[model samples]
Target: MPLSLPERPIILTGDRPTGPLHLGHYVGSLRNRVALQSTHQQFLLLADAQALTDHMHDPAKVSRSILEIATDYLAVGIDPDSTTICLQSHLPALADLTLLYANVVTVARLERNPTIKDEIQARGFGRDIPAGFLCYPVAQAADITAFKATIVPVGEDQAPLIEQTNEIVRRINRQAGADVLPEAQALIPSVGRLPGIDGKAKMSKSQGNTIPLSATEDQIRDAVRRMFTDPLHIRAADPGRIEGNVVFTYLDAFDDDHAVVADLKDRYVSGGLGDSVVKKRLEDVLQAVVAPIRARRAALAHDPGHILEVIRRGTERARAITDTTQRDVRRALGLFTLH
Candidate 1:
């Protein structure tokens, strides 16, 4: 079996295992991955190899997070027995694929990648950016093509990354005079990207603005209490602006009470509703949303060994599929017998 795939197409998606997943992950992709598991052949990667591209000095952080990442996946209802949840480094084929892909792609193309540019600037790499960090998009292409992925679900900001993968696919197929590597399409999520508590564009772990998946109840409450709201909304009776409000944004993502959210927006926008009331509503929404996941994660935390076993078995299965693809890829490039 080529994993559980839909009659339509196969789906491939994953995250770098640099840290535990959070609410942003849940609202962004994890929930969708859970739904896709029964319909599409899904490969959920623990991208430690990719993590090393940036976290080269911190193997210990990556090591601790590997199992935490797995537990988050399980708690969020990713059926590991059905979907392949494996480490990126375990699949040797991906490394080989990356080497071949690197040759076809130029440094100029890598430099122009919007994602890499922002990453390099954010990391404050003055002139000495790591070669691995620069070449990671190619590695991601290898990750996708290693399993012959047809569909990759990602956020809107990642559209350029998928485009790079498609370019590599087309170039490799042209050079080989055959379509061995299928062009992968992106499935952009419908929701707007979640902002950090400070209203930053993204809720990143590094920015110290993320709510951890394993955060304690007190931590969650504190985070909520300090969540940034519209600066204009100072007094309870003041006419608050809801257009760029972070609390309303959280409510949009987490609160199931659409009518209530609508009412709150109107009241706040018009006048007399305080930010505290909206914040309290958001707290209720988040707590209701995360309670079960927290409970599930707590239960699984007791069986760390079992979780590792699941990851090991999934890695074994993923390698089998990637191996076949690698062999074919090498043959296409006339490198199988040579190396």
Candidate 2:
């Protein structure tokens, strides 16, 4: 039910199969997952159940995106050998854990969770909030505690989920008289949130501002060209502000050439830097970053059997580990076990 010291720390992170992951995911968590696999024991969950919280109406979209999301993972170099790629719906333990955790965490606490509150407002759920939607924090605690994940990669906005998970950990341990769940630390990425191509603060598929991982060359170019820039800086001689400018932000995140980006920023601030010039630079940078991922995702898409097999193998492995955790939790909580 809880984590023990292993040779390497356990990290549990995943994406909901609501849509294809985009540049926001690439910079925020995908790159870090690639690097962490070698040194840490990682489990990448295909969170189809969690996807259902809001997407229950359109099951087809979620189903289609499962393969698409898995393809994106392999396309981005997440080795199955190093990282276990598991399906959330396949793990019964998580459902059991969620139910148990719900009994411990209060409704008022769930309502007060900032991340859930923001999402509720964003989705306009209001008083009509889906019970599952309101219970996302509990489900997330289950996901984290299921594998006894000690290191969870999350966005800064998601830090509260991790904090809530630890709170459940403490309460469960108090009842169980043992550490039945381990506290997870949020491992935030260095690069912050990538703005939408429209210059919105958040990039999202639902918002139609996302550039998907499978975006084509033309799509990539079109997105970069349409990127938001300083309206006042219409002329090449006029100074531009980088604060809300999406092109420079992309450059800052994607362009590895510091001196070049620095020069561009200085010129943009002072004057004489055209939006088109910086846009071209961003387009080029994005092309290089997304091209390889697109190609790999295409190749992976051809073999549905292979992707299924990988998910199958990893899910089977995860089932055993999670089953053990369930038994531990049930026994710890003093729940009667027929077995």
Candidate 3:
């Protein structure tokens, strides 16, 4: 039988369990997830399997970071009651679905994926890209379709993955003459990239430019102090440029008072506003945001067993849903008799 669509849209989104979550995650997707949980049937995945595509050599790191990532989620107010938080590896059906979908997509199509291309270049994998890494998009398609997620929240860089996922869905539906998989739409957040303290375009842990959610006041202060600003503005009276200023960018994203931020920007562009003053304001704003989260994470860290229980429960619930999808997929492909 063909799978039926849900009355309320299902949202599927998650993070790779490589390390602790950071400000980039908060501005990009974490805030949106907290807000959308009430309105949609949401499933948040801890994509350890996806993380392994790149970190295959460090299996222990991936294993150890699973609970840490889950703690970050809970710390940021992702209620387990409202959101089903599932680990990717726990759901065997996703792998089965990936295997089935692999034959439908061509190598040329995978190579054309803009996100994959960018990642390959960023990782400097000139010609030695792992087959597993190359095929992760197909697995991601399985992740979305298995849950029948209508909305998949992602960054701008990942928009192409959603497109490729829908293409596979359409191809399979046309070939099987059944809507075995539902297409997912990408929910790209407005505040996409949070520039690193070093003024890099993106903040990543590997780049040594992330402010983790659990950072202390001292750490936050240190990061803000070293934030990149206009090099030309050596003197306090020198006119500054805000175009590529990472400090101002952080203010624009984090500071709630629009009028205050606008006034600061005016002063910054005109001169007389020192980088220290701006950095102080940024530090204050960031502390206000990260303080509560840090407190929550610290409190949660004391009860590792409870966090593990949450993952176990969510995995059980998610497996039931994916199991049904797998059974339907098997029937559609005539792998087994539909009893």
Give each model's whole-structure lDDT.
0.88, 0.92, 0.92
Give the per-residue lDDT of model 3 (tens digit) for 1-339: 566787779999999988888999998889889999998999999999999999999988899999999999999999999999999999999999999899998888898899999999999998899998999899999999999899999888899999999998998778778888888899888775998999998999899999999999999999999899999999989989999999989998899998988998899889999989888999999999999999999999999999999999999999999998888777776686545
Q: What is the lDDT of residue 144 in candidate 2?
A: 90
CA RMSD of each candidate after superposition: 2.4, 1.3, 1.3
CA lDDT for candidate 2:
0.92
Query: Estimated TM-score per prediction?
Result: 0.96, 0.98, 0.97
Ten contiguous residues with the weakest lDDT in model 3: 330-339
Candidate 3 structure lDDT: 0.92
- Comparing 1 and 3 by TM-score, which wins? 3
